[model samples]
Target: MTDTHCTLDICTPDLVKARLAEAADTLRRLPSARLTAKLTAWPDVVQSAATAYGYEAAQTRPAAPSPEAISRMDETLGWLFWIENDGRRLLWARALGVPWRKLEDLDGRSHVTLKKQHDRLLGEIAQRLAGLPAAMH
Candidate 1:
Protein backbone atom coordinates (compact mmCIF):
# COMPACT_ATOMS: atom_id res chain seq x y z
CA MET A 1 0.00 0.00 0.00
CA THR A 2 3.03 2.28 0.45
CA ASP A 3 3.59 2.32 -3.28
CA THR A 4 1.51 1.35 -6.27
CA HIS A 5 0.71 -2.36 -6.32
CA CYS A 6 -1.39 -4.44 -8.62
CA THR A 7 -1.90 -7.86 -10.17
CA LEU A 8 -4.57 -6.95 -12.62
CA ASP A 9 -8.25 -6.32 -11.71
CA ILE A 10 -7.84 -2.72 -10.55
CA CYS A 11 -5.58 -3.28 -7.57
CA THR A 12 -3.52 -0.08 -7.56
CA PRO A 13 -3.38 3.41 -8.94
CA ASP A 14 -1.36 2.40 -12.01
CA LEU A 15 -3.48 -0.68 -12.50
CA VAL A 16 -6.65 1.33 -12.15
CA LYS A 17 -5.34 3.79 -14.69
CA ALA A 18 -4.29 1.06 -17.08
CA ARG A 19 -7.54 -0.87 -16.72
CA LEU A 20 -9.59 2.30 -17.13
CA ALA A 21 -7.59 3.13 -20.22
CA GLU A 22 -8.23 -0.32 -21.63
CA ALA A 23 -11.90 0.04 -20.81
CA ALA A 24 -11.90 3.36 -22.62
CA ASP A 25 -10.21 1.77 -25.62
CA THR A 26 -12.70 -1.09 -25.53
CA LEU A 27 -15.49 1.47 -25.55
CA ARG A 28 -13.95 3.19 -28.57
CA ARG A 29 -13.83 -0.12 -30.36
CA LEU A 30 -17.59 -0.46 -30.12
CA PRO A 31 -19.64 -0.07 -33.29
CA SER A 32 -20.79 3.44 -34.00
CA ALA A 33 -24.10 4.41 -32.43
CA ARG A 34 -25.19 6.04 -35.68
CA LEU A 35 -25.24 2.74 -37.54
CA THR A 36 -29.05 2.72 -37.33
CA ALA A 37 -29.20 6.27 -38.65
CA LYS A 38 -29.70 5.94 -42.38
CA LEU A 39 -26.98 7.20 -44.61
CA THR A 40 -28.46 9.38 -47.35
CA ALA A 41 -26.93 7.39 -50.18
CA TRP A 42 -24.04 5.39 -51.54
CA PRO A 43 -21.87 6.69 -54.36
CA ASP A 44 -23.89 7.30 -57.53
CA VAL A 45 -21.15 5.79 -59.67
CA VAL A 46 -18.86 3.04 -58.49
CA GLN A 47 -15.26 2.82 -59.61
CA SER A 48 -14.12 -0.67 -60.64
CA ALA A 49 -10.72 -0.20 -59.07
CA ALA A 50 -10.54 0.77 -55.37
CA THR A 51 -8.75 3.98 -56.13
CA ALA A 52 -9.52 7.67 -56.53
CA TYR A 53 -6.85 8.70 -58.99
CA GLY A 54 -4.18 7.33 -56.63
CA TYR A 55 -5.46 9.60 -53.85
CA GLU A 56 -7.57 7.20 -51.87
CA ALA A 57 -8.85 8.26 -48.50
CA ALA A 58 -9.37 5.24 -46.32
CA GLN A 59 -11.48 5.38 -43.20
CA THR A 60 -11.74 2.25 -41.07
CA ARG A 61 -13.71 1.78 -37.90
CA PRO A 62 -11.78 0.52 -34.91
CA ALA A 63 -11.68 -3.23 -34.42
CA ALA A 64 -14.38 -4.54 -32.12
CA PRO A 65 -13.56 -5.81 -28.64
CA SER A 66 -13.63 -9.52 -27.90
CA PRO A 67 -16.23 -11.06 -25.59
CA GLU A 68 -13.64 -11.22 -22.83
CA ALA A 69 -12.74 -7.60 -23.33
CA ILE A 70 -16.37 -6.62 -23.21
CA SER A 71 -16.77 -8.43 -19.92
CA ARG A 72 -13.74 -6.71 -18.52
CA MET A 73 -15.04 -3.37 -19.70
CA ASP A 74 -18.33 -4.12 -18.02
CA GLU A 75 -16.62 -4.83 -14.73
CA THR A 76 -14.44 -1.75 -15.05
CA LEU A 77 -17.52 0.34 -15.75
CA GLY A 78 -19.32 -1.04 -12.71
CA TRP A 79 -16.55 0.27 -10.49
CA LEU A 80 -17.60 3.84 -11.26
CA PHE A 81 -21.20 3.46 -10.15
CA TRP A 82 -20.42 4.78 -6.67
CA ILE A 83 -19.03 8.01 -8.03
CA GLU A 84 -21.29 10.98 -8.64
CA ASN A 85 -22.18 11.93 -12.21
CA ASP A 86 -19.56 14.60 -12.82
CA GLY A 87 -16.88 12.54 -11.11
CA ARG A 88 -17.70 9.57 -13.28
CA ARG A 89 -17.60 11.74 -16.38
CA LEU A 90 -14.29 13.28 -15.36
CA LEU A 91 -12.74 9.90 -14.60
CA TRP A 92 -13.89 8.42 -17.86
CA ALA A 93 -12.61 11.41 -19.79
CA ARG A 94 -9.24 11.17 -18.09
CA ALA A 95 -9.16 7.46 -18.82
CA LEU A 96 -9.68 8.37 -22.47
CA GLY A 97 -6.51 10.47 -22.15
CA VAL A 98 -8.24 13.80 -22.54
CA PRO A 99 -5.88 16.73 -22.04
CA TRP A 100 -5.93 18.40 -18.65
CA ARG A 101 -6.71 21.73 -20.32
CA LYS A 102 -9.87 20.32 -21.82
CA LEU A 103 -10.80 18.70 -18.50
CA GLU A 104 -10.31 22.04 -16.80
CA ASP A 105 -12.65 23.58 -19.33
CA LEU A 106 -15.16 20.77 -18.84
CA ASP A 107 -15.11 20.70 -15.01
CA GLY A 108 -14.58 24.45 -14.51
CA ARG A 109 -11.86 23.53 -12.00
CA SER A 110 -8.16 24.28 -11.97
CA HIS A 111 -5.86 21.64 -13.42
CA VAL A 112 -4.08 20.99 -10.14
CA THR A 113 -7.33 20.63 -8.24
CA LEU A 114 -8.71 18.26 -10.82
CA LYS A 115 -5.58 16.15 -10.78
CA LYS A 116 -5.62 15.95 -7.01
CA GLN A 117 -9.28 14.94 -6.98
CA HIS A 118 -8.57 12.32 -9.59
CA ASP A 119 -5.64 10.94 -7.63
CA ARG A 120 -7.62 10.92 -4.42
CA LEU A 121 -10.48 9.06 -6.01
CA LEU A 122 -8.14 6.53 -7.52
CA GLY A 123 -6.34 6.23 -4.22
CA GLU A 124 -9.57 5.33 -2.47
CA ILE A 125 -9.96 2.47 -4.92
CA ALA A 126 -6.35 1.51 -4.35
CA GLN A 127 -6.96 1.40 -0.64
CA ARG A 128 -9.91 -0.90 -1.08
CA LEU A 129 -7.89 -3.05 -3.43
CA ALA A 130 -5.01 -3.35 -0.98
CA GLY A 131 -7.44 -4.54 1.72
CA LEU A 132 -5.90 -2.59 4.57
CA PRO A 133 -9.22 -1.46 5.94
CA ALA A 134 -9.20 -2.42 9.60
CA ALA A 135 -11.16 0.78 9.97
CA MET A 136 -14.11 -0.89 8.28
CA HIS A 137 -13.93 -4.63 9.25
Candidate 2:
Protein backbone atom coordinates (compact mmCIF):
# COMPACT_ATOMS: atom_id res chain seq x y z
CA MET A 1 0.00 0.00 0.00
CA THR A 2 1.06 3.64 -0.57
CA ASP A 3 0.15 6.90 0.98
CA THR A 4 -1.09 9.66 -1.35
CA HIS A 5 -3.60 11.54 0.74
CA CYS A 6 -2.93 14.54 2.99
CA THR A 7 -4.63 17.69 4.17
CA LEU A 8 -2.67 20.88 3.92
CA ASP A 9 -4.51 24.06 3.84
CA ILE A 10 -5.47 22.30 0.51
CA CYS A 11 -2.70 19.91 -0.37
CA THR A 12 -2.57 16.33 -1.54
CA PRO A 13 -1.37 14.26 -4.45
CA ASP A 14 -4.66 14.83 -6.18
CA LEU A 15 -4.41 18.56 -5.78
CA VAL A 16 -0.73 18.53 -6.72
CA LYS A 17 -1.63 16.62 -9.85
CA ALA A 18 -4.37 19.12 -10.64
CA ARG A 19 -2.15 22.10 -9.94
CA LEU A 20 0.66 20.71 -12.09
CA ALA A 21 -1.75 19.98 -14.92
CA GLU A 22 -3.27 23.44 -14.67
CA ALA A 23 0.16 25.02 -14.54
CA ALA A 24 1.15 23.17 -17.68
CA ASP A 25 -2.01 24.28 -19.40
CA THR A 26 -1.43 27.84 -18.31
CA LEU A 27 2.11 27.67 -19.70
CA ARG A 28 0.87 26.54 -23.08
CA ARG A 29 -1.68 29.36 -23.12
CA LEU A 30 1.10 31.95 -22.95
CA PRO A 31 1.76 34.25 -25.93
CA SER A 32 4.38 33.17 -28.42
CA ALA A 33 6.59 35.10 -30.87
CA ARG A 34 5.94 38.78 -31.06
CA LEU A 35 6.36 41.29 -33.90
CA THR A 36 9.05 43.50 -32.46
CA ALA A 37 9.65 47.02 -33.79
CA LYS A 38 12.97 45.92 -35.25
CA LEU A 39 11.40 43.00 -37.09
CA THR A 40 8.53 45.17 -38.30
CA ALA A 41 10.87 47.98 -39.34
CA TRP A 42 13.23 45.93 -41.49
CA PRO A 43 14.08 48.41 -44.26
CA ASP A 44 14.64 45.64 -46.80
CA VAL A 45 11.33 44.65 -48.33
CA VAL A 46 12.56 41.08 -48.97
CA GLN A 47 13.61 40.67 -45.34
CA SER A 48 10.33 42.17 -44.10
CA ALA A 49 8.32 39.83 -46.31
CA ALA A 50 10.28 36.82 -45.14
CA THR A 51 9.66 37.75 -41.50
CA ALA A 52 5.96 38.15 -42.15
CA TYR A 53 5.84 34.83 -43.94
CA GLY A 54 7.37 33.06 -40.94
CA TYR A 55 4.88 34.65 -38.59
CA GLU A 56 2.03 33.43 -40.78
CA ALA A 57 3.28 29.85 -40.54
CA ALA A 58 1.56 29.45 -37.23
CA GLN A 59 -2.05 29.04 -38.26
CA THR A 60 -3.32 29.61 -34.76
CA ARG A 61 -2.09 30.35 -31.26
CA PRO A 62 -3.91 29.80 -28.01
CA ALA A 63 -4.93 32.92 -26.20
CA ALA A 64 -2.50 34.08 -23.54
CA PRO A 65 -3.16 32.91 -19.97
CA SER A 66 -5.18 35.29 -17.86
CA PRO A 67 -3.44 37.51 -15.30
CA GLU A 68 -5.01 35.51 -12.48
CA ALA A 69 -3.93 32.21 -14.00
CA ILE A 70 -0.42 33.49 -14.54
CA SER A 71 -0.27 34.56 -10.92
CA ARG A 72 -1.45 31.11 -9.86
CA MET A 73 1.07 29.58 -12.22
CA ASP A 74 3.80 31.52 -10.41
CA GLU A 75 2.68 30.01 -7.13
CA THR A 76 2.49 26.57 -8.71
CA LEU A 77 6.06 26.93 -9.93
CA GLY A 78 7.13 27.51 -6.36
CA TRP A 79 5.79 24.07 -5.47
CA LEU A 80 8.70 22.59 -7.38
CA PHE A 81 10.89 23.66 -4.50
CA TRP A 82 9.41 20.97 -2.23
CA ILE A 83 11.20 18.26 -4.17
CA GLU A 84 14.57 17.73 -5.79
CA ASN A 85 15.47 18.58 -9.37
CA ASP A 86 14.70 15.09 -10.74
CA GLY A 87 11.31 15.02 -9.10
CA ARG A 88 10.58 18.55 -10.29
CA ARG A 89 11.45 17.63 -13.87
CA LEU A 90 9.45 14.42 -13.78
CA LEU A 91 6.34 16.06 -12.35
CA TRP A 92 6.53 18.94 -14.80
CA ALA A 93 7.17 16.73 -17.81
CA ARG A 94 4.34 14.39 -16.87
CA ALA A 95 2.05 17.35 -16.30
CA LEU A 96 2.95 18.61 -19.76
CA GLY A 97 1.54 15.37 -21.21
CA VAL A 98 4.84 13.70 -21.93
CA PRO A 99 4.18 10.00 -22.42
CA TRP A 100 5.79 7.44 -20.15
CA ARG A 101 7.12 5.57 -23.18
CA LYS A 102 8.85 8.70 -24.43
CA LEU A 103 10.35 9.43 -21.06
CA GLU A 104 11.68 5.86 -20.82
CA ASP A 105 14.12 6.52 -23.64
CA LEU A 106 15.20 9.88 -22.24
CA ASP A 107 15.32 8.77 -18.61
CA GLY A 108 16.34 5.11 -19.06
CA ARG A 109 13.68 3.97 -16.65
CA SER A 110 10.82 1.54 -17.25
CA HIS A 111 7.31 2.94 -17.22
CA VAL A 112 6.46 0.97 -14.10
CA THR A 113 9.50 2.35 -12.32
CA LEU A 114 8.71 5.79 -13.59
CA LYS A 115 5.17 5.60 -12.38
CA LYS A 116 6.30 4.49 -8.94
CA GLN A 117 8.74 7.36 -8.75
CA HIS A 118 6.12 9.81 -9.83
CA ASP A 119 3.66 8.55 -7.25
CA ARG A 120 6.27 8.51 -4.52
CA LEU A 121 7.47 11.99 -5.38
CA LEU A 122 3.96 13.32 -5.40
CA GLY A 123 3.35 11.71 -2.03
CA GLU A 124 6.58 13.20 -0.70
CA ILE A 125 5.58 16.68 -1.78
CA ALA A 126 2.09 16.34 -0.39
CA GLN A 127 3.47 15.15 2.92
CA ARG A 128 5.93 18.03 3.17
CA LEU A 129 3.23 20.52 2.30
CA ALA A 130 0.91 19.07 4.92
CA GLY A 131 3.68 18.99 7.51
CA LEU A 132 3.32 15.26 7.98
CA PRO A 133 5.94 12.54 8.27
CA ALA A 134 6.28 9.08 6.73
CA ALA A 135 5.71 7.44 10.12
CA MET A 136 2.38 9.16 10.65
CA HIS A 137 1.32 8.58 7.10
lDDT of 2: 0.76
lDDT of 2 at 78: 80
lDDT string, candidate 1, 1-137, tens digits: 13222443436667777767888999999887576453555644657466755457867888889997788788778767757777788789999999999999977999999999888877766666567443221
> Which regions of candidate 2 fall more than 4 Å away from where they truly are?
1-9, 33-58, 132-137
Q: TM-score for each prediction?
A: 0.73, 0.71
Query: For residue 29, what is the lDDT in candidate 1?
Result: 93
lDDT for every model? 0.73, 0.76
Best by TM-score: 1
Highest-lDDT candidate:
2
Which residue pairs does candidate 1 place in steric collision?
Answer: none
Off by over 4 Å in 1: 1-10, 36-54, 130-137
**TM-score of model 2 relative to the true fold?**
0.71
Give the per-residue Cα lDDT of candidate 2 at 18.
76
